[model samples]
Every structure is written in C-alpha cells, then in structure tokens.
Target: MTQIAALRVKKPDAPSSAGLLASLRGVSKAYATPAGSFMALQNIDLDIASGRFIAIVGKSGSGKTTLANLLTGIDSATSGSIRIGGVALEQKSEEELTAWRGRNVGVVFQFFQLLPTLTVVENVMLPMDFCRIGQTRDRRPRAMSLLAQLGIAEQADKLPSDLSGGQQQRAAIARALANDPQILVADEPTGNLDSHTTLEVMELFRSLTREGRTVVMVTHERDLGAFFTETVELADGQIVAIHNGEARP
Candidate 1:
C-alpha cells in the first residue's frame, strides 16, 4: 500500500497525549552586531503539545527561524528557558545536546540537504550511524522500512542527484525519521517545492502528527495555515498573535 493509504488506515488508531512536548518561557535571542546587540526574538512563550501540528508564520526577519534554532538547540537563547520533553534543554552541555537532539528532535530543512553522493537509503541510514540508534544488524532494515513508509522505497538505490526534487525531499524526511524522534522541527520545508509537491509533503506531516509526533514548522505561506491546529504569528522579534483550537486562516 502507498504511504498515504497506510496513514489513512492507521491514523484513527494512533495515540494521543495531553500537555506539551516542548515549551519556551520568556525566550529571546540576540546577536552582537557592529551597531550593538540585536534581538531576533523577544519574551516568547509557547507550548507545543504532543501530536500537535503548529505553524510559526511571519515575514522575513520575523525571528521564526531563530525560534526554531533555539528549540532544536542549534543556538542558545540570550535569556529565558526552553524545555523539551520535560527536560531543560538549556541545561545540557553541547555534547549532551547534540546526542539528545538526535534522539528527540528530527529536523527537516528547506533545501532537502541530502548527500549528493550517497544513495537514498544510505542518506537515511546516516543519522542512525551518527546517533548509533539501533544495532548494526538492524539499521539497514529500519532505514529501508522508513523509506518505505515515506513511499520512496523504490528510490533507495538511487543517488540523491538522480531523484526528482520531491523525491529527494521525501528521502530527507525519511532520514529525519530514522531515529523515531518525538518532535519534528522543520524550517521552511515547502519553500522550494511546487504547489503539488508542497501538498504532498504537508500531507506527510499530517500523517506524522497522527502518529503522535509533535510537528513545528516555520513558514511565510499564509495560505497553508489551515494545515496547522495552532498558528503563532511573530513580528519584529515578538509574538504578535496566537490562535489555538482552530485551523489556519
């Protein structure tokens, strides 16, 4: 069966949870520039519950990506706190944060940053190799299964350069899921895709949420807001509005 069809079959039975998987409390990010300290985000508080689909929307320089980086531990907050899955992310050392993020947060980037020389399955397996997620005997099969789950199993043997843009993106998603992470963070994931491909990828994200993964995506596309259960709008480094218990505008 196709990935979409499989998702449809299993979605109804997926688990659900209350409360949050990650939260930001008075979080802010600032960088020192030639002029002075420039704040990219300010006094932000947000909660992302397990299995929720959230979209952070804003124009350029609105601090959407900065917020994502903080959540994923790529960058530290200038002040305030960030908690992920009940653990304080800011408390961990860089080494610990790296390992923790690999096991807990799966990240997808806009450009589908797959290794050009590696075959599709190899790219998916790379995360497992770095994180040492599963036993040596199990990694390949697990990667294959994940690729199959994303409906790209047939492309497993091909290099990333040989696949279509959408296929490469799907492979990247499969790589992100290699460790079965609880939270998925995406930065402008559909930015480089055509409308049809964007829909396909968004549908895949919906499927992931149905499987009880928390998905937080940053985008400027207001038309795609309906896909999210929560919408957080940012302007000038601050959260301007939050809409919950509703579809996108």
Candidate 2:
C-alpha cells in the first residue's frame, strides 16, 4: 500500500462538478450461469464531468469492466438509468444505441482492434466511414491529424502487423478519436504492453483530458492511478472507495 500512499496527488485546478457529463443511477447487472444468476454490479451511482481522468480499479470480478461496459453501452444493465451528456441510454433500441454510441462515445479496447488488412490511417478513417461523420475528402486529413497527434503519423500507411504493440494501440486510440466524441472509455488499455509502452499510452490518455476529452479507464495497475484526478474503486460489485486528489468541503 506504500505506493498508493505515496501517490497523494493534488488537483488544485479541478473542473466544476455542477455539470455531469455521465451519470449512472441505481445501476445493476446480473448474468445467468450454470450455477445461478450472478450479480456483476449492484446499484452503482457515479457521476463524471468533462475533462476528468477517472481510473476504475478493483480485483478480478469486482465489476470494474462491467462498469466500463455500462458506460460505453457495450453491455446493458439489468436495471437502472444511464445518461451520458444528458442523453438516456435505457430506452434506445439496438440500432439507436449503436448510432448514439458512435456519436457520443469513443471506446478503446484492451487489445488493439485495428483491422489487419488496413493501414493505420485507414483504420482511423473507418469510423468516419461507418458514421458518415464528414466528407470523403475530409476523412483522410482528419485521420492523418489524429495519427499525428498520437505520434504515429509516420506509420500512418503501415499495417497494424508492422507496428509495435504500443504503436498499434496508439493507432487504435486515433481511430477512437475519429468521431471526436466527448467521452473516451478504455478497458485495460495497457494490459498487453511493456512498462515503457504502458507509460507512453497512459501519457496519451492524459493529453486527451487536457484537450477537454473526459477519459474513463479501467486499470488494475495501482501506480497509474497517480495520473488520474480520482480513482473509483469497486469490491463485490459495489463501489467501495473513491480516492480523489481534490478535497471536499
């Protein structure tokens, strides 16, 4: 616990909490298995603001991933209301949710989910094609810009197989940012990389918040929490603690 104790950060210039960009109220998720129904999350209520860096951490089966999935609308909660940027998610149909999620949220998977056949820039541009975000002529420039921002512009023409793991992940992030969504959600983003690569990817995440992008990342690595404005911890499908750098009156 010394490492956790040593990471007593201070976010003196924190953003206002008056306007929540994402909210989960009375949320719960249960799955049916051979044994019985298992509760993955239980009545979780969380609020996150724009430009905040949040680390959701816990042991295995603690609902950290479930919480992320709920936020991204990748998985539906058994019960509760989920609203992101003032839009409700519960009543949306599958098609509606897909369109809405593509418009509002950007998700980065643990493994770099780039299509092996496409070039890095093409991978980034794929989102725009799927969502029809902009003109065809504009997509390539936008993709190029994202790749440049992620420090992978030089490898924009290379296939994912040719890039290093970190580079591939960076490309994936660029692809996620293609739609310019307000919220960015990542699940164990650095789980497949070395420490140095992990730091690089984490640094990129930090840079996103500075650019007014709210970032919610699930991580088991305690050390990475130091960079976040706050850490939300879970245990037994419940929020156990929140370690925050800002003080409350």
Candidate 3:
C-alpha cells in the first residue's frame, strides 16, 4: 500500500457534490460484424473528475480503445448515456458532435497521426483551423508555443517523416492540445515508443493534470500504472475493476 501510495499522483480534490467532468452511465457499445453484432463494451459506468489522470488497462479486444472512442465522440454508444463536461453525447448530432469535439476534447493517437505533408507546427495548427479558434494569425504562434512546451520547438518546421517516433508523437500531442481542450483522450498513446520515451510521455500527461486538464489514456502497460491517479481494468468488453492507482482487485 505504501508503494502504491508513492506511485500515484496527488490529484486535485473531487468536484464539490455537483458532478464529474465526464460520466458514463450504463454505457454499452456493439458493432455490426460478419459474426453478428460484436460487443465492444458492456454496461460501463465511469466518472472522470477534472484534473485527474486515469489509465484504462486491458489486453487486446478488451474494449479499451472503444471506451476512448466513446468518450471522445469518435464513436457513439449502442445503448446508454455519455456526458462530458455537462454535454450529453447521445443528444448531439454527428455534425454537432464534431464541432463540440474540436473545442472540448483533445485526442492523441497511438501511431502519431501527424500529416506527412505538413510541417509539425502546421499539423498542430490544423485543429485550430478546423475549430475556427482564435485569429488565423494567432494560430501559428500558438502551435509553435505548444511545440516549444513539448520541448520540440526546433522540430516544428520539419515534416512528420523527418522526426523520430517520439518527436512525432510530441508533435501529435501538440496538435491534440491545439484547441486547449479540457479533456484529453489518448488511445494507446505510447504503443510505438521506447521505454524512456514512454515514461517521458507519461510524465508529460501528469504535468497536464497539474494544469487542471483531465486525461484518459487507453494502454495495456499495467507496469506504467504508477503514473495514473486511477485505473480502470477491463476484460472481454466488461469493466472488472476501477480503483485508485495500483490497487487492483
């Protein structure tokens, strides 16, 4: 218990009785597959507080990414409710969801989804353009600042292919933060990085929490559980446990 205590971050206090930053109540997701309807998630209930770093851990086909997608509005739930920052996802149209996602959610992909043709800074600015955030002239400076904060300012002008995997991932993270969203969802964010880079990215996420940003990450690496304030473990599309830090049951 002492070891686990040391590993976990000192998260911000829970919200004052009002509600959570995000809530999933009786959520289930199923996809139409050749083998009938495939259930990716079943009866998921989760509450994410603002300024908390949460790790969703599970093996392949454990519904980790599916949960992330649902939170980010990339995919809708088959049956149930998902509300983030007081906005109910089920009530929004696809077009409305897209616009809301641009301003409210930041998504980091596993494979560093930076555009190959655009420079790192340009890639970061793409989100701002799509969301129409701030003046066009201010977007470049904001992108550069984000890259600088990620310690990759020097790589800002380079193409994604020119950067290393870690650098590219940093740029992708910069792009994710382009709109300064309150919630950041990462799906297998460090799946392609080396151990050192993985730790670096994890620490970066911790720092974000310090700034009052909520981070939900889907990762299979239970060994990195120390960096999270909470852990949600899933198996065969069902949440088996949700506990604080390394206290698995």
Candidate 4:
C-alpha cells in the first residue's frame, strides 16, 4: 500500500446494506423559467447507506446535478423531504444548512473550483477555516496530510494553475475531505479529465468508501457502473431503475 493509503483509518469490513446515511422521499425541485415554472426534479425517493460508493447516472439534463444538489442542501426542494445522517434538511434555514453542510458533507464539483490565487494546500485548508474544524496551527499539517493521501502533497505550495488536471482534481478531493465529513458528494467529478485520469480519480473515490465514507457521485459514464455499490438511473428527473450492487447469487 502507498504510504498515504497505509495511514488511513481502516474500518472493519462493510456490513450488509443497512444503516441509512441519506434519504429522500417525494423530493422535487422547480425553477422559475421565462416560460413559467420548469420542473428540474420530481418525486425522487432514494436511500443511501454508509460505507458505500454510489453512482447516480443519467443522460445530459437527466437531473443528475439536481439530485446531487438536493443531497448537499444546495437547492431547496419544492416538495418532500431530505434527511442526511438523519437530520431533516428541508426544515433547516439556509444559514443553518450552510453551517451543517460545511461540517457534515464534503462537496466536489467538476470544475475543480480551487481559488486561483490560493496555493494547493491553502485551498484544502479553506474548509477548515470556514468550519473551525481544527486548531489554526494544525490546519496546514492536516491539509498536507490529506494531499499526501491523494498523492499530491508535493504540489502543496503551487497554485492550482500550476498543477495538471489530474493533480488539481486530487487537490480538490483533499479539500472536500478537510472537515472529515462522513459523506462526500461529487457532481461529475471526472467530467473534465482524460480517460486514464478518470479511472485514477474513481479509484481514489472508491478507496474512500473502504475507509467508511459514503460517496455519492453523479456520473454519465455507464461503463463505470460496476465499480459502484449501487447505481441509480434517472430519466427526465425521475428514477427509472435502481441496481443494487452485490455479487450475483
């Protein structure tokens, strides 16, 4: 195992698919369009368990991003309920949700949204700053450790622009993990990378699940379904099929 991999907290084997981490029931979202209200998502009922890698897949405009946003409390549901780690999201105020989200959920976007001016390590430390997660003196070491785990610690002092696409994504993953969230939500995280980089990034995400983190990702790559513990397929904002990942009997 790589040194960083060896440093991870090894949890016991993942148990039978129990223990709900996040759930949604009758969830829907609508946006005001010039043509009037446009429904972005409708009646999504999903149950996500801890210590599993889940992939939410659909064609373009199939509400993949919308589902992720709802999971992370970024978009308000027009109807229904969302509970993550058992906390009801629909009832929390925007301000309260922001704080809760910062501490409980780590989000990764496709764009690798690192501040251009901040050094790679600083980007990772930013989450700790906002959440007040650790001692100010210890934040840098923690961020460096996360970067090392992702194999990008050598680039810590460099700006995002100086890193390769794969390295930048690695750095972003490190940042998402800054607060040690139990759940990690990623939307099209590999959309901008090349095929090899895509696989590498996916492998890193998969490893996180082994260490007891629930990973929810929105992806269009159908071929990668086999790597996930569950695959939820969406069409026109509704779930069409849910393939529970497990060895065939």
Q: What TM-score against the true fold does each predicted structure earn?
A: 0.90, 0.90, 0.91, 0.90
> Model 3, stretches more than 4 Å misplaced?
1-16, 247-249
Per-residue alpha-carbon lDDT of candidate 2 for residues 124-172, written as tens digits (9 for 90 to 100)? 9998999999799999999998888888899999999999999999999
Question: Which lDDT tens digits does candidate 1 get at residues 1-249?
Answer: 121111010121223235545567888899999999999998887665544678878889989899889888888898998887788988999999999988877789999999998999999999899998769889889989988988989999999999988998899999988887766789999999999999999999988777666678888886786688777778999887776644343
How many clashes in each structure? 1, 0, 0, 0
Evaluate model 2: give its lDDT.
0.81
Error of 1 at 68 (Å): 0.6
| Candidate 3 Cα RMSD (Å) | 5.4
lDDT tens digits by residue: candidate 3, 124-239: 99999999999999999999988998999999888899998889988988898888786788998999999999999999988877766667888887578788878888899988
Task: Name the runs in model 4 displaced over 4 angstroms.
Answer: 1-18, 246-249
Clashing pairs in 3: none
What lDDT score goes with residue 18 in model 3?
Answer: 45
Q: Identify the leading candidate in terms of lDDT.
A: 3
Q: Candidate 4 on 1-249: residue-level lDDT in tens? A: 111111111111323244656667889999899999988899887766645677788888889898888888888899999887779999999999999999887899899999999999999999999989869999999999999999989999999999999999999999988988767889989999999999999999988877767678888876677678777778898887776672111
Worst 10 residues of 3 by lDDT: 1-10
